[model samples]
Target: MVRDLDHALKHVSLRAPAPRFERPRPPRGVFTSQQGFMRALGVGAVLLVAVLPFMDASRYTMSIATSALIYVMLCMGLNVVVGYAGLLDLGYIAFFAVGAYISGIFTTVLGWPMWAALIATIVACVTAGIIIGAPTLRLRSDYLAIVTLGFGEIIRITANNLKITGGPSGIHGIPTWSFGPWSFDDGFNLFGIDFPERVVFYYFVAAVVIVVGVIGAGRLAKGRLGRAWKAVRDDEDAAEAMGINTYIAKISAYIIGAVWAGMAGQLMATHLSAISPNSFQFLYSALILMAVVLGGMGSTPGVIIGALFVSLAPELLRDFAEWRYLIFGVLLVVVMLFRPSGLWPATAVLPWLRRTRPTPPAFTEATAVPASVMESVDGTPTTDAHEGDRA
Candidate 1:
């Protein structure tokens, strides 16, 4: 039986595509390596953020930009769960709320510094991550999603009912980060230009935070942990057979994602100076998930772009009036139809531009046993007689 099984497996080619049909790959525009593409993208994002303030922009414009940055962070965090680990979490916003409320309580109730609130939020989020992931990570697909959705709603409802969270009105007067007398709350003059202190400083802070988040997420996605996540995501049984602890990998992904979301929530709380149950509805969860899908899952650049689109499309299309959402729906449908793998998928890789045939081996190997050679009964060549003839 063992011999038969090994023989049967040996004949099965490992290189075949899945039984399910996959969409045709889109053409690679110009990128040859992942590193080059990401570097270009990072530089462009930094340049764009740097120049936005100088562009005669209004307060509304700055607000939109700030919101977009927050969305980018959220989407990237979710990417770890959905994109890398292949987990379908419907209520990821629960962690966001967890972070926000924890940080809010820390700052307002305990009168701690913003940095302390940030650290406490991360710790709480990690604890929450373990609690939520322990049992649900054992489930798969829709079963997992249902539990997450329930968890999300539970968090929201609990916040609404709790007095410490300020009931439905939520918590306010959450303080922003400050260093002694110099605070983000205080505006100032720079390079002969008087800027609105809160707007400029806050925007700068958000941008820096987001930039760091993007880099950190990208780095994690490229490391050993990421490989384990991908292995489990592709096939849990196979991953286990290969000695990978699928459960641990899944839980680690959840925890890391939780940490990212928690930090973002801290920023969100600080950015808005308030927290309400209304702010963490299922609608926001759905939107963030949509952004992950619409942007190529597991692709950092794609996720960022997707986040920006989801966050800004409503405001950008407000001029279209009642037809705005309809138009937006149509556009999303078009993108799905045309680029189902996403506008830029993570799996895109450049083929070798130059192909070369393998070099030939040196003398000892015989080609076709050579027409002139004579063999003895045991298949040893008659070279002994040939040696005397040559001498």
Candidate 2:
């Protein structure tokens, strides 16, 4: 049988197969081509903000810039809950209010320094986030939004009824940040330029805080936690299948967002020297949410750009009067119509592309020619043989 099979195989002929194997490719760095461009844009923005106050910028200019920075920080915080974790929160302003209120209570009522008040504000925000998130994080879509909106209203209404919070009039006489003998309230002269008011110093301080917040948010968005948040955002069921605790991941995002918002609230309280229940309105929440969506969700640069536009567009178009908002609405519609997923979408890179070591496929299904295609006269099988003439 063996001889017959061998004889039959000898009659079959085919071209020799070529030797082949995959060559190892180096893993791509974390910074993709487009990401590099965004880095450049961020650096330029930082430099511009840093030098603006020194370039004969008017008081109004610094004031507007300061407000824009606050929005940027708020939008970035929202980016975590809405953008990264994919949670729908309509009452995010509640956290902002909580932070400001906590700081205000600590400073004006409790006689705590601004720095210490800031610490208390952060703790309170984080705690509030957990309390709210524990109950509502499981909800999805409109349900989540409605629940959060209710929670926000509950907070504001409660504040309005409380004497400690100073009722509807809110807290006042909030002091600027100070340490030891130094206070941000004091004016200073730098080089040939003299800052006559606290606005310039406040502008510098806000710039620094905003820059740090942006950097921190960006880092969080790039870390392991960030990936988990994105995973939950994409598909909670699938993410759970992959062993990710969607609930925990979601709450984590909420807490981070709350902390960021709280810090921003503290800044707002000090910057304006007061906090009112009216400031934490539903409209502000809507606007912050809009800024994140208008800019690219999950995109740091897009959020910043969106924030600047939202905060400054009103001032820039003031000449248009009431028509300005109509025009702005039209422009927003146009932008959304053109780029729906935002200006910069969060695209996932392949494992091999993002990791230091590329993972190989486990097993490949065989779909080619069968291993044994013919049987010899002696009842022995022969490997693939091309049809041909035989003696």
Candidate 3:
């Protein structure tokens, strides 16, 4: 029996041979080799903007770009609350209103410096975040959304009725921003192109701030805190078991989001040189949220593109006037229906961008032995030869 089994095993091994080459595979993670492509795309975008003045940098176009940049900032802020933390905050524009009102007061009424007013704006937004986020964050999903919506309305109404906010007339004649010897009202000639002083400076300023915010949000999303927030987003129970404080994480997301929005409001106040309660209406909040969703929630590039479309599309369709909004609504609905994940989904990368692929599986070595050793030295077989025979 042992001799017969040994012959059968050798025959099977000879018939089915293992591969000649075998090696362990490489580990997986976000690749650094693709950084060059990312950098190239970024450079290309900047170059396009730098050349915009050459192609009719009219006041209208520049102003549109400036407003689009502000919307980008707002969309990024909302992305933090909705995309990263998975919180639906419908009242985010309230923080913008608060910042505008607070800074407007310091600059217009008290005659404080614009820089000082900016500081006040930051404080007001942070305070508002804690005040609103602290209590509402304890609730889940729809309830939280409803509370935030209410908070937004309350802020708008308060601004409309308040004495300091200038009632319905709102604040006007707010001073232009300046830093030391440099003023936003100053213009310079470059490459034979004469740009408007105020518009050009704020355009660059808003662009810089938007870039910084994008980079900051990207870093935060990949950090330890970001992972914790994802944990809370994915499963609260599992995150709690893993020792995360979900409540604190949610509130922190709100505060960070609010700070970005406040800075955006400061930009707006300086750009318009005046602000009204009408500027911070519920519709504005809804619009910003729409930008975030349409751009691809949690994606920086997607959000920026989304913001530009939302802000600029209607302006470009000004000829249609009344019909423009109807067209806009239809476009959004179409986008949502077909590309529910947004135009540029957060998980997607350009085709030209190639990250390193995962390594292949390794081969294992198996020994081929004579069936004579299959016996336990007492005439019984140590192998499952009988089972194979039964099969």
Residue range with the least summed lDDT across 10 consecutive positions in model 3: 25-34
- Each prediction's RMSD over C-alphas, in Å, is 9.2, 9.0, 8.6
User: How do the residues 1-391 of candidate 3 rate in per-residue lDDT, one tens digit apiece?
Assistant: 6666666656443334455457553323223334555566667777776666667677777777777777887888888888888899999999888877787889889988788888888888889999999999999889999999999999999999989999998999877776777666777667896667755755665565547577888899999888878788888889989999999899999999998889888878877888998898889989988998998987877887888889998998889979999998998999999989998887876563445465566655543343444542345655544445557
What's the TM-score of each model vs. the native? 0.80, 0.79, 0.81
Cα lDDT tens digits for candidate 2, 1-391: 6676567667655344432444445433335344555567677877887777777567788777777888888889999999999999999999999989999999998899999997898899989999999999889999999999999998899999999999999999998887888777676678876775555655665665556678888889889999999999999999999999999999999999999899888888877888889999999999898889988898887888888888999899999999999988888898899978776555633344456454563443333223342444445554543322221
Error of 3 at 45 (Å): 1.8
Runs of candidate 3 with Cα error greater than 4 angstroms are 1-36, 189-194, 351-391
Higher-lDDT candidate of 1 and 3: 1
Cα error of candidate 2 at position 151, Å: 0.6
How many pairs of residues collide in each model? 1, 0, 0
Give per-residue CA lDDT, model 1, range 1-391, as digits (tens).
Answer: 5565455456543343233333444434336445566677678878888788788457787777787887888899999999999999999999999999999999999998888787899899999999999999999999999999999999999999999999999999988887777777676778998677556654665665556668788788889999999888899899999999999999999998898888888888988899999999999999999899998999988898889888999889999999999998898899989989987788754355234333443333222322123332234444544354558
Instruction: Quote the positional error of residue 387 for candidate 3 in Å.
Output: 38
lDDT of 1 at 32: 47
Reference-based lDDT, residue 385, model 3: 49
Check candidate 2 and list the clashing pairs: none
Q: Arrange candidates by lDDT, descending.
A: 1, 2, 3
